[model samples]
Structures are given as structure tokens and as C-alpha cells.
Target: MTLDDLFSAAREAMAKTHSPYSKFPVGAAILTEDGRVFTGANIEVVSFPEGWCAETTALGHYVMGGGGRITDICVTAERLDECTPCGGCRQRLAEFAPPDARVHLTDQAGITKTITMVDLLPLGFKTEILST
Candidate 1:
């Protein structure tokens, strides 16, 4: 699917976020290698660390649904305009998505930007390094 399609899906998913703490509703959509899309919205908890991020939520669903090897990912957040994933999220995404996995960001006003994992997390470490 095109980036526009991904952004649209991510934006729709963002509508379901339950982030009352930060009021930073965010969503994520992951496209599997098989062309299936999985979406998720951020869920916040009273304790910050207990909260779940949109990217992890979506990837977890893909794993539970027997889907792995994500090819691309799109993220949207009104409060996070042009904001990329945090360090933890970048590695989390890298674990499932390939080196070329793409991430899309969008604002509430619909301004969108596309970036690859490499751009978000340069010199990313891979599992292969562990085996070496």
C-alpha cells in the first residue's frame, strides 16, 4: 500500500487511543510481508511505565495473530507532529521489521512525513550481531 494509505489507517487508529495522562493519543499500523495490516492505539495507565505504546501494541497483535516479519509501519499523533519513536520503540520495531522498515508520522492537521528505521535509529544493532 502507498504511504497515504498507511497514514490514513494510522490516523484512524489514533482516534482510539486512551492516553489520558499525556493527552497524547497516538496510533500505529504495521504492514506484514504478506500485505496484511495491523493497527493499534496507545493506552495509558496511571503509572507511566505500565502504559503501552502504539507501535508495541500493534506489533504484539501481529505476533499474537501469528503474523511476524513486518515490512512497514506508520505512526500518527496529534501531539507528536514529526516526532519519531523513542530509542526503545526503534529497537522494538527493528526486532520484527526488516532493516528497510519504513515509519510514517503525521500530525492532527494531516501533515505527514515518511522515514525509514535507519533514519530513526542509525547504526541499529541486529540479532545477527549476537550470533557473530
Candidate 2:
């Protein structure tokens, strides 16, 4: 899928964000290697820690749909340049997306920049990192 399409999906998902607490709505869309796209919005809970991030939610949707090998990802929030994934989300994404997979960050204005998964998490842990 094109970056424009991915960003559009993310924007649409952002409209469904349930961030009553922080009001910091965010959205994410992931493109599978098979050309399928999955989108998700951030959901906040009263418990605070129960809040779910957009990236994680998108990944869950992808997995539930039997998708594999994410080829690209787009994230949108109040500010495009500032919509980078958190450390935990970065690691989670690394589990599914290859190091060379593109990650687009965008907002209402437009796409801010694109970076590879490895650029987001240079030292992501892998199964091989754990010696038997």
C-alpha cells in the first residue's frame, strides 16, 4: 500500500481513539507483507496502566486476522513529528516488522518523516540474543 493510504487509515483510526483521560488520541496502521492493512486507535482506561497504545492495538488486529510480516507502519497523533512509538512499542513492532520495514509518522498537516524499524530500535532483542 502507498504511504498516503496508510496515513489515511491511521487518521481514520485516530477518530475512534478513546482517550478520555489524557485526551491524547493516537492511531496506527500496519501494512502486512501480503498487502493487508490493519489499523487501531489508542484506548485509555481508568486504571491508567490498562491503557493500550495504538501500535500494540494495531499489531493485535493484524495477528487476529492471521496476518504476518509487517512491511510498513504509519502512526498519527496530535503532532506528526512527535508521534514516534515508545520503547515498548518499538520492541513489539520489531518482533513482527523487519529492520528495513518503513515506519511513517504523520499528523493532520502531513507526513513528517519516514524511518526504518531498525532506526527506531537499533538494539532490539531477538531470540538469538538469549544464549541457550
Candidate 3:
């Protein structure tokens, strides 16, 4: 799917965010190489550390659906400037998305920028590390 389409999915998922604590709703949409799309919204718990990021949730949904090889992912939030995935989420994405996979950042004004996952998380830890 196109980046715009993925952004739209992210927006839709954002509407379902259960962030009663922070009220900083976030959403993510992951497009697999096989053309499957999985959307997720941030879920927060009373304990801050227990909260799940939108990207991580989306990745989990994709895996649960038997999807693999993320080709692109879009993230959106009210504050566009802070919509980028966190360090933990970035590492989680690196587990599935290739270095060249597209990472799109979206906001109320629409997509802000599109960069490769490598640009976001250089020197990511991959399976090769475990094999070694």
C-alpha cells in the first residue's frame, strides 16, 4: 500500500488509543511485503513501564496474523514532531523490517518525512548477532 494509505490506517488506529494516563495518543500502521497491513494504537496502563507503544503493538498484531517482512511503516500522533518510534520500538522493528524499509512519519499536516529504518536505527542488532 502507498504511504498515504498507511498513514490513513495509522490515523484510524489512533482513534482507538487507550491512553487515559498520558492522553498522548499514538498509532502505527505496518505494511508487510506480502501486502498485508496491521494497525495498532497505544495502550497505557497505570504503571508507565507497562504501557505498550503503537509501533510495538502493530508489530505484535502483524506477527499474530502470520505476517512477515515489513516493507513500510507509518507512525502518527497529535504532536507530529514526537511521532517517531522510541528506542525500544525501533529495535523491535529492526527485528522484522529491513534496513531499507520505509519509515513514514505523519501528523495533522500529513506525512512529514519518509526515511529508511537504517536511518533511524543504524547498527541495529539482528539475528546475525545471536548466530555469532
Candidate 4:
């Protein structure tokens, strides 16, 4: 799907968030190399640690549905600046997305900041050590 359409998909997923806990909803759109778009929303749990981020949720689903490479990604929250993925998420994303994958952050004005995985995760540690 196109960028606009992808954003819409993420927004739709955000609407389905069950956030009675913190009310800080997050949405994510994962684009696959096969041109498939998977969207996910943050699902908070009473046990905070059990909660899974929308990005990881989507990525997990993608991984289960047959392995595919990620093309680009977009993360959105009530406030875009506050929506950046955590370090764990950045590494998880780097697992599938290319170093130059575009990571978009949708802002309040509907504008977005385009960044690459390398920029967001410089010197990111992959499984290279484990493989070696």
C-alpha cells in the first residue's frame, strides 16, 4: 500500500487499542517485501511487563505468517515525537528491515519525519556475534 494508505491503516488500528490503563495508544504499520501491509495496535495489560508494543505485535504476526522481509515502517501515537519505538523495538525491527529502511513518524500536522534504520540505530548489534 502507498504511504498515505499505510498511515490510514495504522490509524485504524490505533482506534482499536484497549488502553484503559494508560490511554497512551500506539499504532504501527509493517510493510513486507511482498507488498503486504500488516497493522497493529498497542495492547496494554494490567501486568505492565506483559504488554506488547504494537510494532512488535505486528512484526511477530508477520514472522509467524511465513517469513518475509520488511520494506518500510511507520509508527504513530497521539504525539509523534513521543511515539518512537523503544531500543528493543529498534533491534527487533532491524532484524527484518534493511539498514536503510525508512522509518516514518507521523506528526500532529500529518507530516512525517523520514529516517533510516541505520540513523535510528547506529552501530546496531545484530546476531553477528552469535552466528560467529
Q: Sort by TM-score, best first: what order? A: 3, 2, 4, 1
Question: Model 2 clash pairs?
Answer: none
Model 1 per-residue lDDT tens digits across residues 43-62: 99999869988888888888
RMSD of 3: 1.3
The residue-level lDDT of candidate 4 at 25 comes to: 85
Residue 125's lDDT in candidate 3: 79
Better candidate by TM-score, 3 or 4:
3
Candidate models: Cα lDDT each: 0.80, 0.89, 0.89, 0.81
TM-score of each: 0.87, 0.92, 0.93, 0.90
Among residues 3 or more apart in sequence or in different chains, the pairs in candidate 1 whose N, CA or C atoms overlap within 3 Å are: none
For 61-129, candidate 2 gives per-residue lDDT tens digits of 998999788889999996445589989999989988899999998768667789999999998898456
For model 1, the stretches where C-alpha displacement exceeds 4 angstroms are: 109-111
Shift of residue 5 alpha carbon in model 4, Å: 0.8
Output the lDDT of residue 18, model 2.
93
TM-score of 4: 0.90
